[model samples]
Target: MAWAWLVSRAAALGSGASGLAGRVWKIGADDPRRAVHGLKVGLALALVSVFYYTRPLYDGVGGAAMWAVMTVVVVFEYTVGGCVYKGFNRATATVSAGAVALGVHWIASKSGDRFEPVIRSGSLFLLAAAATFSRFIPTVKARFDYGVTIFILTYSLVAVSGYRVDALLAMAQQRISTVAIGISICLAVCVLICPVWAGQELHRLTARNMDKLAGAVEACVEGYFAEEE
Candidate 1:
């Protein structure tokens, strides 16, 4: 009987733990903010899909159009400011790097067709190595870190991939455009829909914490005096 009772208790405890674990996932699931975010995600996907399928808007871009949608997926944040910061970083990196890639391609092209591939490869390796070292610098990493990395890759594709295909400049341009479209979509949703701002929330939380700490100290002092009396 004791063994049976112990088993039953263990099973009850297991069930209780499982229920607690399940409830953890549901935290804030019913909150209006969560609902708004869900709606935004759905709407963004649907809207991008429309653009994805439309030939005129995405013509010649082919599957590359998905990169635009991918950017939106990765950059979208619950807060408007968060989304904007990330989107801006990505867009800046994409466009700035693309421009540099075009210039690099033009330079590398002058080195004869056979030598072009070798030059492009060497340049890619050097750029990647340089970008790695650059990213460790606090000041540079703050803004241009992503830009440096993307610049290397974009420069590589435009210069090296040219041997395999035509219109290297056009490909570079399309990629930049796709990234811009993605950033635009994310920013629009984050701002126009139930807008939230992380900076404001952070400030509010700091104030609440200060207020609570003050109240707790006051309560403790009152209790201490009461005990002395």
Candidate 2:
């Protein structure tokens, strides 16, 4: 059953990616909006690459710079609003989760390596169970779903990664910083560079549809009264 579910999820993701790739090349200058969005995507990725290559902050943020770069790739959207919403979600989720992970690592570190495996493994199970359960509640799930998801992932990484790395909290901190940086870059680029807003597009579409509907109704009413004239 689990294998079947995994396969189904993978297939869905692959299908969606293929569909987007197929449509991307079809975009042309006739629809400049698509071109603009494509440009934003490219620019965001370029910024990520620049940060990853340049160890501008060689202190604590260098090791996990790739995580920041990855965040930029995943967080950016065609619309400014979408980018903002997802950027906030990703950063909030990652930082909150990383804090918890760091706390667990600290406790394990003081206790010594004899109990490290047991402590880390136990924490992973407990955290995952609670988080997975919390995700079912409607209101809770809607807002902090990403947070819960990230918490689990971050905890697991810390648990396993601490075994090899002496500075578990340091790594987690670096990861959190990288995520913030990546999200900031994405938000800046999306807002400053020929910004497109989802809310504005939605309003425009709604207004246009209402106008079209009104025109159709007026035409129909006039035709119905023609016999009286």
What pairs collide in candidate 2? none
Q: Which stretches of candidate 1 lie over 4 Å from their true place?
A: 1-26, 29-31
Top candidate on lDDT is 2
Task: lDDT for model 1, please.
Answer: 0.77
What's the distance in Å from true for residue 46, model 1?
A: 2.9
C-alpha positional error of residue 14 in candidate 2 after TM-score superposition, expressed in Å: 25
lDDT agreement with native, every candidate: 0.77, 0.81
Tens-digit lDDT string for candidate 1 (76-117): 889987787677777776776667666667776787888877
Cα miss at 209, model 1 (Å)?
A: 0.8
Worst 10 residues of 2 by lDDT: 51-60
CA RMSD (A), model 2: 9.0
lDDT of 2 by residue, 54-84 (tens): 6676444776878877887888888887887
